[model samples]
Target: MYSTILCRTIECLTRDPSQNRKGDPGVTIYKIELLKLQETIPDLTRFLSDSECQRANRYHFIKDKNRFIICRALLKLLLAEYTALDISQISIEVDAHKKPYLPSHPSVYFNVSHSLDYAIIAIAENPVGVDLEYINKEFNYKEILPNVYHQKEMDEIEISKDKYLTFYKLWTRKEAVVKAIGKGIDNDLYKISVIDGSHTIPSSLVCNQKNLYVFSFMVNHNYIGALALTVPINNLDDILFQPLPR
Candidate 1:
């Protein structure tokens, strides 16, 4: 599954952006460059249709465009085959509380996160949620901690030391799980405590809850990542990470 995941990432967004997805003519050039990158994912090439191009154009913001491009490209990459308009199509409509979802491919669950200059797209066989945050600035941990942590957790790490990274991981993990459930941060972050770091995800998370399992990890230097997999994993090695093709 991990190999398949990385292979899919490189194969789907096979083209490179001649120019970054920033600045003027950004949207148009980005679309063109990305579409060209489709060469990387030879197997999924059949899925990118002329109609999806028209649909991608509806977005005007660069961030929105980038996200959409990755989403669409990944959709084709994931299923790795021709799909009917209704089956392959992904239409995002917020949940009751405004959580985003693609009812079209309910099984092709995913979550995307952006932190500073990086974008993370985590896709799963079932509903999934992901989030990443950059900790480059000094933040008011004292002020924000109360919002997300339970009293017991606060007591667990009672030190005069800085746990900024710890806090970010906790925050991101909570956000990822809640988002995966389509409840967003509106749910209690404290109720769902999970430890995160460079390689390990807390044991509590590995245990199945209504069939969902979450794994958290770090990327690059400053970003913290957490993925909420709707279906529990038999092995952590099954999760994969792949950089987008240049």
Candidate 2:
């Protein structure tokens, strides 16, 4: 079931920008298994900028250091692939909210998220945000449910047969929307209502003054993933999923 879709994968837009339901915005998501990154790119540091290399060294733990290095390298590689630019030509900067962006290439928007051993990178022509979380079945979601979800959402979760699944699905949506807005998550999470009946369809909402469309999917049996786009997408087939070779 879910395991079948969890391969080292990248979800891409199958349709061309001209065929988009809204404006010409093409969004693609790439899922990478961090543990296998080094084997694929032995010298990831070569792809990273000097500042990024320094940041990688700042991590006290080796695993954390490797994760940062691998993620950045993969990002640069993917950006290069999409824009037909040299990896070194792509310069990344962060906004006041700490959202990373391409200072040189504003039209190319992207977001990155990783949980446990996997990382998901989403690149788009329009503003976009993505989140991937390893669903922890043992987590005591009840302890903070009220603080994070709207009253109606909490009621829906409480009444749902699979509370954990419901919580993660909704939680990922909130995270995706917040990231898409390019604003740091402050205290307004509970105000965002993401509990629409069907999980298969993209839902529209206005958050932090930005209109967004969010869609959720399972990365694997243990992980839940979501994507947020600034523009609406009428058909699910517009988004395509590709699994990287193991």
Clashing pairs in 2: 8-244
lDDT of each: 0.51, 0.73
Model 1: residues with Cα > 4 Å off, grouped in runs = 1-90, 160-162, 196-212, 243-246
Which tens-of-lDDT digit does each residue in 1-246 have in candidate 2?
010010112244544433425443377767788887766555778888789888988999988888888888888888888888898898889888788998878888999999989989988888888888898889999999878987888998989998887888888888887788776565767766677632221122233343556777877778878887777555443344444422
What lDDT score is found at residue 160 in candidate 1? 22
lDDT tens readout by residue for model 1, 89-202 = 545555676655556655555566766555566655566677778875477677766777877556544552647766766677767776766765643456565642222333
Q: Lowest summed-lDDT stretch of 10 residues in model 2?
A: 1-10
User: What C-alpha RMSD separates each model from the true structure?
Assistant: 11.2, 7.6
Best by TM-score: 2
What is candidate 1's CA lDDT for residue 78?
39
